[model samples]
Target: MKKIIPYIFLISVVSCQYFEKEVPSEQELMEKQMKEINWKEVDEYPSVADCEAISDETLRKQCFFEFLASTIQQKLSVDTLSVLYPELDTIEVRVTINPDASMQFEPQFPKDTVAYDTIKIDSILRVKLVDFPKVNPAIKRGIPVKTQFVLPVIIKTEK
Candidate 1:
């Protein structure tokens, strides 16, 4: 029994050395933490007032798009200049919704089209955006954030 006790103690001390966990270096820890941060996902999507009640994220996004398009169409339909411009083909507009619900617009038109006054387009868009329904800004880590969307506006000429 005395011999067995000394052998068990030796085994335990050796086993504990192997079981000890090695502390990660500072750089390794930082790299691991950086990998945990996700840049692609937002905690909540930007939503119009009408879409705020939706629970599903995909549906909420779809609802927001529909609401935005409908609102823009409704407001723009009243402005003849917006729909009809000389030699205007199709333009892509970048719309950014700020955390405070204000909007910034940037329009891109093809070079092949006839030159048009950008100031007029900017003013029209500004006025239309003022009438847009208030939106809940996107949330990243529980903080409201500005979100941008690129929308295509097609201009159709009468035959």
Candidate 2:
């Protein structure tokens, strides 16, 4: 019985190792791709004022300066998070923007003067793994893993 138990344990350990998923090389590939992405293209936008005009009054007043931050400015100033893991066939990214309410705008400020407001905007990016043919084969075959990246985005408007 002792011998049989030892054999069973040995077999189980070997089988577990055999069944374990291997790490994919997608991390290196993703990092290379991320480094090559055109940051300017991602940051470029038509107008900040137009973007701000669509927000509610509370957001409008609170995020007044943030609403004035152009995509270019944001791209130039904000940091980005990027990661790659195995098992994800496709990455679905969702962006959400939340404005802070503590900020107040002073109407007396000059048009060109950049005013600092207490309002802060939270930008969240949600990433999910999905089944798709375009995903890396190695990643698809490995253990399923998903990753999310969040960034604080300041929306800007035109003068």
Best by lDDT: 1
TM-score, predicted candidate 1 vs. hidden true structure: 0.79
- lDDT by residue for model 1 over 101-157, one digit each (tens)? 787777766677456777788677777767566778889878888888887765444
Candidate 1 backbone collisions, by pair: none
- Candidate number with greatest TM-score: 1
Q: After superposition, how far is residue 62 of candidate 1 from its true place, in Å?
A: 0.3
**Candidate 2's residue-wise lDDT over 10-103, tens digit each?**
9998899778887759988899888886543322122234334554644543443343333323432333222121222221222222121111
Q: Which 10 residues in a row give candidate 2 its minimum summed lDDT?
A: 129-138
Candidate 1 local lDDT, residue 100: 81
TM-scores for all predictions = 0.79, 0.23
